[model samples]
Target: MQGAIARVCVVVVAAILNHPLLFPQENTTLPDQDKELMARMREHEEKLEMEQAKLEKELSQLESKQEESSSEDGYSWYFWSTLSFVIFFTIELYRVDLTDTEIKPVEDEDVFSESGSVTPRTMVLDKDVLSNFCDKCMYTSSHENWRVREFVEGFADDLLESLRSVCDRDADMEVGDFVGIGSMFESWKVCKPLMCDLIVPFSPPDPYSFQFHLWCSPSSDVPPGLQGCGKIKVTKFGENEKGCLCGSANMGDDMLCLLHSRNDTPKVDHSPDELLCSRNTPFLAKDQVMKWFQISVTKAWGRISHKYDFEVTFRNLDAAGALTIRFRSGKVIMLNIIPVVQLEDTDAYFVSHFPSDCDSPPDPYWPLSFAVYEKNLLKHFAKRLPQNSCHLHCLQIVTFLHRKQTGLTGKSALTNYHLKTALLHLLLSKKPSVWGVESMEHRLRDLLSFLQRSLQEKRLHHVLIGNSKVPGDVQVPLIIRKAEPINLLRPLVLQRELHAATVRHFTKC
Candidate 1:
């Protein structure tokens, strides 16, 4: 046993001496060339190790540089600029690309006119393909829309009827008409026709009413969060016996027409002197009215929901106190029942959750909403469209893009409402012939180009508010009318580079 152990120990010692990993010293008895070769191999390993460490350091530096580059697209100086428009209606639409010092000048727009197309491009998907695509999409959507409309009309009739019966107890809490709105209601809906907009008019407490109020400078008392925007107020009131400013003269016609399109002037004072405002209304919290609406609307719908097969849900109360209703059948139907007042003779409009004012009382009543009048204008645009025109098609496509990219609704910034505002501007700027089928692709490009230019200027002028183009009777607040427009998507410019991509693809088609 001792002999066997001794032999094994000797074998282990020899193996350790022979092993390259465990033994550091090399055999000195080798030839000179072999020794030189081994020295060269060791030098080679040392070089590899040095190279790897250097590469690791360089990789870390590159990663940091990439992170910094990513942040550059996050902001632009245009966001903080003051809005300006020169006297000529010919706008110098431009962009200040932060990444490039050299900008490609836009083709001279001075060459174009309302009556003619721009220098015709060798654009693809020309007239025929575009017209056919629009038709098929419209045809596909119309049936679903008809069914949804029929269902909603039935639902609204029963709902408003129930509201009228139970709402008699509280005069201020009473809801007036139930009118449908939005793209779905207007029949321009594309892929998803699941939502519906309904206007539910609320009667204001006597004497007090909603109007546009602009804040011109610092020291002006505006809404709590809106102190930074001391530019203009779209709200204004005229003198009357009840201390109420009727937009008719008091209710000024054409004043509120910019936000939404309307032809008829206001004829009646919805709230007259004999109908006194409620003394019980709260001053500080207009939300109290929203609370009133939430309870009154939900309970009112409860009495009527049984008549329809769908489930009625009061999803949320918006900042202005508008109530959102979600109807669930096989699909979802979103109904926005907004309380509003159309200004008397002036034809301006206001919503129930009173717009926050600068000079007015700290407490609020209904502000203003122009949804109905806006939709009314949409109807006019729809009716006048040439056969298979791209106005509705273009609107639907952009609207879908807005919803998909932002997951937003009309209430938010860059809403379908804003898109409509852009469309209205284009409609008014050019002749109906300019929106013909052959010009569909260019018209779409033109709208996107218009938005890009406006964004770069940091001002998307409110259509209802005063600007270079608004009517005389339309009294938008000086500060609000002139204040820098909201740059809601300033930080998100990259997430939606789709506008350029859209033009590129369509032009190629």
Candidate 2:
């Protein structure tokens, strides 16, 4: 910039010297007064020459300073780069990768012997490190969690009661008392926008009753992929029966009546279209069930909309009754109000889908859910376990890992159900003494190792099905206890490509 200014000054002096007013043509003579103007012009030209010289000097100094700055920046860059590498190396030495068996040590040893030989030692990660990690990432704030749960449960109670009233008055459906299930109720929830699962059992009005056909039964003719699934047949009770009758003959017209009654015709109030059954067949269709459920929930929410301070809407159209409630404070909560059919007063229920389910079974074949029983079993085990058992902690950590893995790799076949199943299996197999809080790290390692092996073998079984290890106090259904073991990973195993991807995902976890 200074160099350009010096050139501009030189140009200005030349223009002034050649100007007609300042300096006339060389061949022409100047007047006396003009001579004085010429002297002043010479002085002005000298001052311009001095200013140009000063500017050139300043430009040279600026160039020198810039070169110095460039050299200094290069040195600073090298210094910081080296320092960053050293810091990274130090951190890696102490860092523990959860998937690895042991933490890598700095160099190969901590110290050198006097004989110029290296002394090696094993560097195991401290148990406190794992404990701290669980506290940091695997657990949720209990007080905050309770606050949210209280608000959610209170809201849900009102909403569901309103829904029950609506269904009883307007539809052929009779909604019963809802039973809470899933991780939130089980008390191992870690991931957020707080979620809650509810099993809302319902029955058909008047003469209609559900007839469950289990795949595990000796007379079942279900497909191979339909293991652990059952079809619900909508059957009509005989005209004579007015209440919960014991005999199958009194329940449906398909069977011959045992007791004598004067009435010959069944009193049916609901049409076939209004019911959840298929057009021709008596079996309940899942698609129709979802459609009916979505519509009923909408109407129910509409009825109680004025009572609540939040807005409720369906989270996913494909999911039957998945709802999201948004508060004025910008807080959101997810609630899954699953309509289920109780398996003859047992803890198990026939559900359309589980909260952790990634895929839906074929239409009309509802999968059996023993979530309530599982929750009970956990409670039973908790009482028997040593004080401050690490079983829940282990479960939380594995589930956290599964969540993180799912996020990294979008929509894997592996799910939270698989992780929970693995934990339950381990709990049943191992002694209660092994689950003490101090052994949390070991238990977590074992859990992961067990999960990895199970994924490899593709043989994670249903905990309540054919499990002789289950405690009698847990009250699992007798039929489920006697049935053949249903492998949960069978679907993943059948599809070779999917199974491979699922295994890779678990390994990463």
* Alpha-carbon runs more than 4 Å astray in model 2: 1-126, 137-140, 168-171, 239-266
Error of 1 at 11 (Å): 61
Q: Report the backbone clash tally of model 1.
A: 45
For model 1 the TM-score comes to 0.51
Candidate 1 per-residue C-alpha lDDT over 1-509 given as tens digits, one digit per residue, 9 for 90 to 100: 33323333443444333333322244333455786777875776566556656655655665565443223332321221111122111222221232122333334443444533232332223467556767787778789788877877776777667767776442354466666766777777775636666666555433234433433335545564332222211121333345423323444653453333355443234332122323342222334445566666677777876666656665554432233334453566655565544445333344443221222223343333445545666566556667667777777766665666543222233456667777767875777777776677888777766665555443454454444453333344354456544432332354445444433222221
Clashes of each: 45, 0
What lDDT tens digits, residue by residue, belong to model 2 across residues 57-121? 76577556643345555666466556656655554554324213232344423343453332112
